[model samples]
Target: MENKRTEISDLGEFGLIDRISQNFTSVNNETELGIGDDAAVLNSLGSRIIVTSDMLLEGVHFDLSFTPLQHLGYKAVAVNVSDVAAMNAIPKQITVNLGLSNRFSVEAVDEFYKGVKAACDNYKVDLIGGDTTSSMSGLVISVTAIGMVGQDKITKRSGAKEKDVICVTGDLGAAFIGLQILEREKQVFMANPDMQPQLDKYDYIVQRQLKPEARMGVVHELAELDIVPSSMIDISDGLASELLHLSRQSGMGMKIYEDKLPIDKQTYDTAVELGIDPTTAALNGGEDYELLFTVSMDDMEKLKKHADIHFIGYVQSSDKGNIMATKGGNEVEVTAQGWSHFKKP
Candidate 1:
């Protein structure tokens, strides 16, 4: 049976908003009011609130040919939440603004919201309000997440001191390698429609690309362990690029051991099969959404036993420069070749 398509024009904006608003219920007490109002209200929560927004364009940020609407919706919320977690904040609310073209139907929007609701549930956040409007060409998603952190507990990119232990949560490069596989399979499908996608074997890497989780678990664990990262950022634009962000903001140099970099077995194997240097992918492949942070040496023992946390390096004075010690005993300046959305073709 074919899915029924209800045109946005037929329902109009108010009707569409009504349909969407009915599907969501506020989960956070901080969200005093959600949807159907001129503006949403949030309680003070007795802490500093952090806000972050991200925009995703159709062809630029994603390819719908291989991307599922459900995953895309989840990712949009997760990425924003990752930013809040990087600041050592607890996410409370989000407002999503979507630009849809006529190509999308009510069913498509419903699928997208289902993913959104799932993310809200997972992150313990409330959907306060959002706007939906027509687009000129393709789909556009903009999400703004609001979170709270105590003044003393908030982490910034500029807090690293010399010799602070650099730590990263989880493995890397799987998402980028997954993208390579998806692109390859997309090409194959375009060439021959009858060929089924060879994706079952690449499930881990593929899912990493599709549905990434924010390191809220790490944040919560850090709080439980009574440890606060000196500085932190999510690995959204690859490890190397984010490391440079810390370097520049904190006015410190970094020394990371190449051997200490985290790469999953699946990511490594796939990178090699795709002829990409696994280390390079770990360094420059973006969208891992793992937390990269620094902690005082005194706090190292607290995290040493944690299986997913890897101590990759230490911070140094700015005069020493940003460098990575390779496995072959050579040191090279870390370069930023991660995602550059504005880079010209």
Candidate 2:
């Protein structure tokens, strides 16, 4: 008998998601959404519920050699919280599932839990439940978060209207630049095990990559300012990819200013040092974990003084297509070069 085989690359990341998602039908009317979006929105008896999950694997998501167990645990929670914030909801509970290999000691597991507990306390979320199992290959961490938001307060990627001003929290590219530096240092150490890592100068970007903070404060501040973004999505998959999500979901196009795109000084310098275009990194670097949202033009004043958020563009008619106006004053079509774990082969 001949074996059937197909390459994961042929489907691509989005294709795989779509193919898998097609089989599952939303049985519950309360499940306003299921897959594809920053988070899933469900209608509860009272307030609406926001649910999101993320899974991190040892070799794929992080390298145990450099990434601390504590930070990994904390980051797992932070990424989940960031999704809840994207829905303009308050995270309440999270259930974690972990798989461990014998290489890890009991103390190492305890350290991971400490970080998880710290994140729960900081986010004001309950560590309601979890499961642990033994794995033969590598460690695996999966977390699912539940949050609540008022019906009117809930935001979705589809709510964006034509002409809505697109905004993003904080800068981009730092995390990717940080990853580059870490890889370089890792290689240097490999060639000569005695070599000390040159990490002091790359502290900012390194932290940005390893200990990324979810912009939960932005959600609180937006509420305080009385400005609810018409649509919201988190920047887990590069700014350019996120913009395309907003545009496709909202049935609109956009024109973002290249000069208006935000990048930290450290990120810009590191990108230059690595012979990478800073602007390209800002557009395509994943793992940023910041919020990318859209708001009414009139509400712009409410966020005008926000130090971290930058207004880069506005939604346009869908026919014009999503574009970025370059610093050179030319428009270029936005493409998604987001991370695809399926590309491993």
Candidate 3:
């Protein structure tokens, strides 16, 4: 059976907006008004609002060759929500803007929105509004997420104090390793059309690359435990990169033990199979979407039993510098060699 493909011109811009708006309804109390208006309105009540915007370009942020439109849409929202989670905030609303080329059909757009809708439901956020425009280039997605946090609960990268314990949620390096497997499979498929890519064994890492979840549960759990991080940043970049961010912003040094770094068995074994050090992957691999944070020694006991969180290190004076004590009993300065969109050739 042949699939139906409706052109975007069949609906026009406003018609397309109307079509997209029909599928989404605001579920957030803060969202006083949503789609079909000049601008969405929000009622923040007394909480401080945190806004974050992220843009995903076609070839730069993702490759559509093996990436599904649905997963891409879900990822677009997840990355932005991860930013909100890093601030210790509750995501309330999101506005997704898209630039679609004529090559994209209405059905294709629908598939993408299905993923977006799934994410909105999972995160308990409302899809308020967004813009759809024609594009000469491929698909472009820009997501802006709005979250709420009480003044006392808000966390920032610069709030870490000396002696505070460094912690990370979930694991690291899986996403980076996943990307490698994807690219490798893509190459194999390209070289031999008949070759089926062996991806069943790499399911976890592949999903980490394709559909990452924002660590909102951790944020909620922290609130329930009455523990607030002194400093926090989502591990969108590598762990080392985010650590450097905390060090530079907090005006403190970090000392993390290599053995303390968390790594999944699959991520570690796969890294070894690929001849890449799992520790290096955890250190410099980007897009983990995990939370890297710090808590004072006083609050550390509260999280001591948390299964997902790992105590990796502690904050120190700037003179001591950012160092990672190796399992071999050696110290080395941490460096940021993670993802860079604009790197000099």
Candidate 4:
């Protein structure tokens, strides 16, 4: 039997909203009022509340040709949670707004919410409220994540001090390499419809691109260790770009050693195979979603033994400028060559 298809038009906007609301129940104590209200209510006991919103547009941020609806839904939530984690806050609630074209069905919407529910469970956040509207364009997802952190523990991009140690969580560049593989496979399939995508060997990098987890565990670990980073930012737009953000915001120069940069073996090998420099990919490739932070020398000692955190460099005076020391022992200026929404053609 063929799968049943339900038209979204059959159920009006209110009906669709009711269907979506039934699947998500509030679990967070802060979420006093979830869906079915004009606005979600939250109780922030004594902590500082942080809010972040991110939008993903089809044919821009993602491609439906290879992206699964479930994965896209999960990714949409994870990216916003990453922003919360960057602030050293615990994500508590989210409001997901969607714009769907006629091509999407009620079943398709259900499948997308399945992924959203999975992410809510994983991140321990409540799906409080959202809006759904018709769109002439493809799918558009906008997730607004709300989190809380102690007044003393919140980290920002402008808090770094001179001599602070710059640290990064997890390896970089795998996501970008994965995108390359995906685009290549897409082209191959376009050229010859009969040729199936050979993606078994590229599983790690491909998954890195498709489903990235927010580093909330690291935030908890830092609290347990009594370490608060002086500055922090998620590596969404590549290391070089994020580092520059920290440098400019904190008014400090950054000096990172290329040798200390973390690159997974698979990412490195794949870049080599594609005639791309691994270092270049690590520095300029975006969407890694890892945390890049700076801590005092004393706190650095505490995190030096962390298996996942790598010490990449240190902050310096503004006069020193932002530079990276090459493995060949030469220092060169670091530039932002990462993702830009609008660049001259």
Clashes of each: 0, 0, 0, 0
Query: For candidate 4, what is the lDDT?
Result: 0.94
Candidate 4 root-mean-square deviation in Å: 1.2
Off by over 4 Å in 1: none
Predictions in order: lDDT: 0.94, 0.84, 0.94, 0.94
Candidate 1, residue 273: CA error in Å? 0.5
lDDT of 3 by residue, 60-161 (tens): 899999889999999999999999999999999999999999889998999899889999999988999899988999999999999999999999999999
lDDT, candidate 2, 179-287, per-residue tens? 9999999999999999999999899999988888888899999988888899999998899999999888889998899999999999999999999999989999889
Candidate 4 lowest-lDDT run of ten: 1-10
Compose the digit string of candidate 1's lDDT tens values, residues 65-110.
Answer: 9998989999999999999999999999999999999899888888
Model 3 weakest lDDT span, ten residues long: 1-10
For lDDT, candidate 2 versus 4, the one ahead is 4
